[model samples]
Target: MKFIAEIDVMPLKEILDPQGKAVKLGLGNLGIQSVEDVRVGRHIQLHLEAADEASAKSIVEEACKQLLVNRIVESYTYYLAEFVLSN
Candidate 1:
């Protein structure tokens, strides 16, 4: 079976996001305002071949906890779905 995973990696709420701040500030310069506490994150799409959805979810979770996220400063969320043929 094949599965698809969508992962989001972002800094913890207590952490500051310089890039997001910069973008927010820049936006103000462009006449956009009323925005506060902006945050930036990464999105990852993965495809895997596994025996079942549970196995695929475990593998993806391990990958995120061990490599994709910095555990201490960042956090991650993921969703898994069975791959389906369009035809």
Candidate 2:
């Protein structure tokens, strides 16, 4: 079976996101004042072959823990779905 994983990784709330803050400041300078408290994060999409949905999820989780996310300062979330082929 084939599965698709959509993952999001973000800095911990306790961690300061300088890039996000800089972007917010830039936005304010550009007259986009309504957008505040901006946060920047990473989005990843993966397609893989797995035996089942459970297996796919486990793979994705392990990937996040081992490589995709920094446990000390970042957190991650992901969703896995079976891939369907269209004729």
Candidate 3:
């Protein structure tokens, strides 16, 4: 079976995000001050073969624990589902 994994990685709340702060500052300079705070993160999609939904979830979790996430200052969340082709 084929599965698609949608993953999100973000910096921990206690961590400082310079990029996000920069974006917020830029937004303010552009007269967009309504935004109070901003946090930048990464989104990743992976398609892979698996025997079942459980296996697919395990694979995605392993990938996140091993590489997709930085446990020190970042965390990750993922959603897995069967892949279907559209006509």
Alpha carbon lDDT of each predicted model: 0.90, 0.92, 0.95
lDDT accuracy of residue 2 in candidate 1: 84
lDDT ranking from best candidate downward: 3, 2, 1
2 or 3, greater by lDDT: 3
Rate residue 32 of model 1 by lDDT: 86
Between prediction 1 and prediction 3, which has the larger TM-score? 3
Q: List candidate 3 segments past 4 Å from native.
A: none
Model 1 residue 24 CA deviation in Å? 0.7
lDDT of 1: 0.90
Candidate 2 local lDDT, 1-87, one digit each (tens):
999999999999999999899999999999999996988999999999999988888899989998999999999888889999987
Give lDDT tens digits, candidate 3, residues 1-87. Answer: 999999999999999999999999999999999999999999999999999999999999999999899999998988888998887
Cα RMSDs, all models:
1.1, 0.8, 1.1
Provide the lowest-lDDT 10-residue window in model 1. Answer: 30-39
- Candidate 1 deviant stretches above 4 angstroms: none
Give me candidate 2's TM-score against the actual structure. Answer: 0.95
